[model samples]
Target: MKPSETVLEIDLKALEHNYRYLASKVDDNVKKLAVIKAFAYGSDSVALAKKLESLGVDYFAVAYTQEGIDLRNGGITQPILVLHPQSTHFQEIIDQCLTPSIYSEFVLNHFIASAEANQQKNYPIHLKLNTGLNRLGFDPKEVPMIVEKLKQTSSIKVDGIFSHFAASEDVKEKEFTHHQMDTFKKVSDQLIENLGYRPLRHLCNTSGILNYPEAHLDMVRTGIGLYGYGNSKEVDQQLIPIGTLKTIISQIHNIKKGESVGYNRMFNASKDTKTATLPLGHADGINRIYGKQNTNVSIHGNLAPIIGNVCMDMIMVDITGIDCEEGDEVILFGKDKSAEVFAHNAGTISYELITSISQRVKRKIIP
Candidate 1:
């Protein structure tokens, strides 16, 4: 309740609302896969996943097998997809009924053996073809051969063919984006024609959903957009921000013109100022790069600039001439400032900011 000993509040209703908003964006033919990986973008995946399960989310996606297991343990019966699964967890995956994105031959073989050993007949799997991002997914040249090999397997089933869009939000780069889309379509066609048939054929992230409706063939995997950050600034303006991150000012200090605050005296008061120190720092996922440039805290609904270097467990904000004192509430990030703003300061995206948040911060599920 106080600023210094702050708690990060998560609105489950807001989470549900955001889910429904993105769900509304999808055509009836397309199923929405809620991306809850990385602790649901550092907002507590277990709790959010439960609420999402109640909301009838068509599917859930996690980055690894462990996250998927945690959801299953928490009683999430909805289909869960592991985007970055390990071969060691192949048996566990079959036991838990988890879907995995097959990217390469190594993963395919492990999954095939695990399925066969477990007598898993037609266990659903998604084929991730590398369009152009080249971060993950199977190369285009490997699709035909991989399909032929999977035909030999008895238990494994190809459920979907998917890929990622690197820059669907940038309309100026439409040519390059379309090129990737074209390549993906061609490879997907080849896989389906050669392999016989697959259930779902998708190639859309949030931005792609808004830009190219044709890409939404079967299902869509959405991460940041569902959490209310948006595909990009321009597109998200219409969407309500669902996450509100708050902290508190622990102490207030008045400094003379020459007095300094924070580590190594990085910030010396050029004029008489009232600075408020927040019990939040890079340790809480507020990266140090947020200091000095484009970084500030919201105090009493007003923006307070962060001064000096952000400490490991605290940050100092210039709250001069504002009606504020110790134990006042501060907004590190939330609906008001937006996570994108914080990402902009850190030279990253909201997805990274949320995923990178440390586990030390206390997350409070709020109304």
Candidate 2:
């Protein structure tokens, strides 16, 4: 295979393993919804969704309607849930058969009006309850009003009801997590009692799946976990990271003591040092904060400390005593260092690091 300057290698086998691993955590009856938002967390959404579709994933979700449309255009025929649908996209959502997650009275009414105006019948949608996240979702007190509004319209159907967990991974916040679950249950039960039937109810994200099995409810949504992270050491050990960020050393420089490297002269060679310049930087999602001797990249199984401010298009790493030349492979965050570890060194989380990878970077699938 030909090489690229910077590439994200996605291991399909590892992705499948992660899906199955998360699947194994819940009961057979519980459906798994693959959250592929943010381009599958900066992998390839269409490609990843295609893989998951073949694996019999019960449902797929994206953060917006356009992402769902992208999947549809990419030949994904499975049911898609739009987690945060907008009023203007109702027509497209209906035209494409994408289910919207209606969270507010304004959104709910706008969608109902759109459905009625289009003369659509039983259009499917998911209801999002606030349940303490408070980012989006209908308030619990509005449940009855929402149900009544739905009853008045033959144009829309509630296929599911769900909520986001504020912090299911934090053991110290166990009580708060349970409280959110309880609130979801109360709100969902009230809707069911009024509507005379229960839509699918889900409340667990990836962390919730690992920590709160009982709260899995009717279905579970797996996002970061499906990309091979468990948010903790023990759980992460059981999962395989699917994406590997790699690049090649563009050049090597032998600098004498007192010589500076990269912008702002942040790194000065105290001793005669050999440095390797890599073709990756802030533009490729290597955050600026990761520079100034804050992060390291692995070359030839050895850790090479970053020596200066990460540039817009390149970075210099101290490669002294390491037998590496230009064109040698350098692993930014992959099997050697792991995204979690790399992100931690930068004072951030793996999710931010992975999703921040520039779209210009090439993505290759490993079969």
Candidate 3:
């Protein structure tokens, strides 16, 4: 059935396929932690998380405390790691049973204080190490201080230690990635020696899982992979894009040569032109960069170039010589017209493009 309005259709079967394909990359014993932050990369997080939970994924991760809370409220019972936690939300995090990633001295100290005040024992917390990402996590030199602080508190226990990859997908940066892996290994060994136990050590993002299998330590974390993007043309073939952005043609016009269309008259018909207006624009997710023939939408398997400046709520496309009409279904991006191709046309990446879709846009889940 064709959707009457603009919708981001999320395919659960494609999601499951991506998950199982990624699962096949690692051994059965290595735990899989699915990253469902930013509303599951702007596709429904709760729904995707629920589906992954049923698939027996070992863990889930979110970018903030509230995201983890949302998962919990949505009835997700899996262990969720708050990747970038703030000091102010310590109590709320504890109240919601969300494990936090202690990335620095400030977070580590604040979390310990919060846990102690609440009289919580062995509250699980993950230590994030700075392994060249330099975005977050404690530096390698801070390991001694970190271990000392842990000895001083029973309120919080290090349940896991992980790091982020700066560029695991780039083969040119393979040397740097190996350096990060070596650093993480050194830090983990030191921590285990001092703490007398080993926590789950994971350093793989989606690319790392596919490119460097040896780095798949006790557990592996995957974000974009589960959502159907593998960061490269070759690996992308092995995955399936789970979200499809679609809309309907709202109106059509037949204009003579020299007639202008859309805001600013950016598009003037050089010849008799057939134009179609779509019910989506920059306000939805299609950035203005995609306008002026930068990208094309699929109408009845034919291509129609976006013909003018993108407006707040609409965009006009040149359907000249194409078989299309008002109320006809349009494929903005999907399996046939991939989001990667759509984003590439506008000089962007899939992550930014897909995640940029406004929350106001309706979401429809499919089999």
Candidate 4:
């Protein structure tokens, strides 16, 4: 029997399956860094990190310093790379033994000062290269200046040099992707020569690991793939989505023709209709875009279209022909019920859908 309340079931077995599948694609020599940022893409980050640690994952990464601190508090002893560290939390980062990705000259200088003030020597840091992302990273032309600063500071050491792909998943952007890769390699090589030592080189993201095998380098970072999405239908087949969102029909309503339902009468019944109300709504991450029959939920193995405007805590689905009643199990997205499909119907993606799941929803981990 399914739980009465809205619940997100995180399946560890499926997570392991996805991990093993991705690991199989890489060589034994290359290290695998699991991207656990955004609460592991909106699933339990600490829980998932611990599981990946036990599986011998080489490293873990998070977006912010607090996220890394949370993992440390949760007993994740694995090395965590704070992808976007702020100057204010530099001391906390060092105290917690978390590595910071030094992206720009400002970040680099600030981290050095913090490490020195703490009397730390040879603190590990990763240099972020721009490589066409145009987001956060040092331009390739800045390699000389970056190395000069590194020489002046003994407080921090270059542990790794990495960059993000602009579009590894799209074959149409192959030229741009390769240019990014080549630029990373050239800049990395230049930095290595200037520093007189080779740090770990990692540039491939999830799609890069699959599409551009040669660029796997010394390590690869994967986020979406680990959560069972390959960014494409063909690749997604080889992965298993780990999070299953389920809820129950809170109430059922029968309306006659010419009756209207929900806020502002957004859904008007032209014929007699039966509707099932679910406990989850936009507050739980089912965006308002999914309402008005844009998507559906699985009830009694029947697809029921969501009707009317989605409320803050509820959504009504048309279940006129479905064999379901109040309190019946509702599968929002899981197993054969694809989250990708659910998100695409509303001009979104699984990453947003899964990560947007409100923390208030009950989480049940299937170990």
Query: Candidate 2's C-alpha lDDT?
Result: 0.93
The deviation in Å at residue 23 for candidate 4 is 0.5
Lowest lDDT sum, 10 consecutive residues, model 3, at: 317-326
lDDT of 3: 0.93
Clashing pairs in 3: none
Q: Where does candidate 1 clash, by residue pair?
A: 3-248
- 3 versus 4: better TM-score goes to: 4
Clashing pairs in 2: none
Location of the lowest summed lDDT over 10 successive residues in candidate 1: 1-10
Worst 10 residues of 4 by lDDT: 139-148
**Segments of candidate 1 deviating more than 4 angstroms:** 1-4
For each candidate in turn, the TM-score is: 0.95, 0.98, 0.98, 0.99
What would the per-residue lDDT of candidate 3 be over residues 1-367, giving only the tens digit for each residue? 8879999999999999999999999999999999999999989999999999999999999999999999999999999999998999999999999999999998888899999999999999999999898999999999999999999999989899999899999999999999999999999899989999889999999999999999999999999988789999998898889999999999999989999998889999999999999999899988999999998999999988998899989999999888867899999888778888888988988998889899989999996
Per-residue lDDT for 1 in model 1? 40
The list of candidate 3 runs beyond 4 A from truth reads none
Ten residues in sequence with the least summed lDDT for candidate 2: 1-10
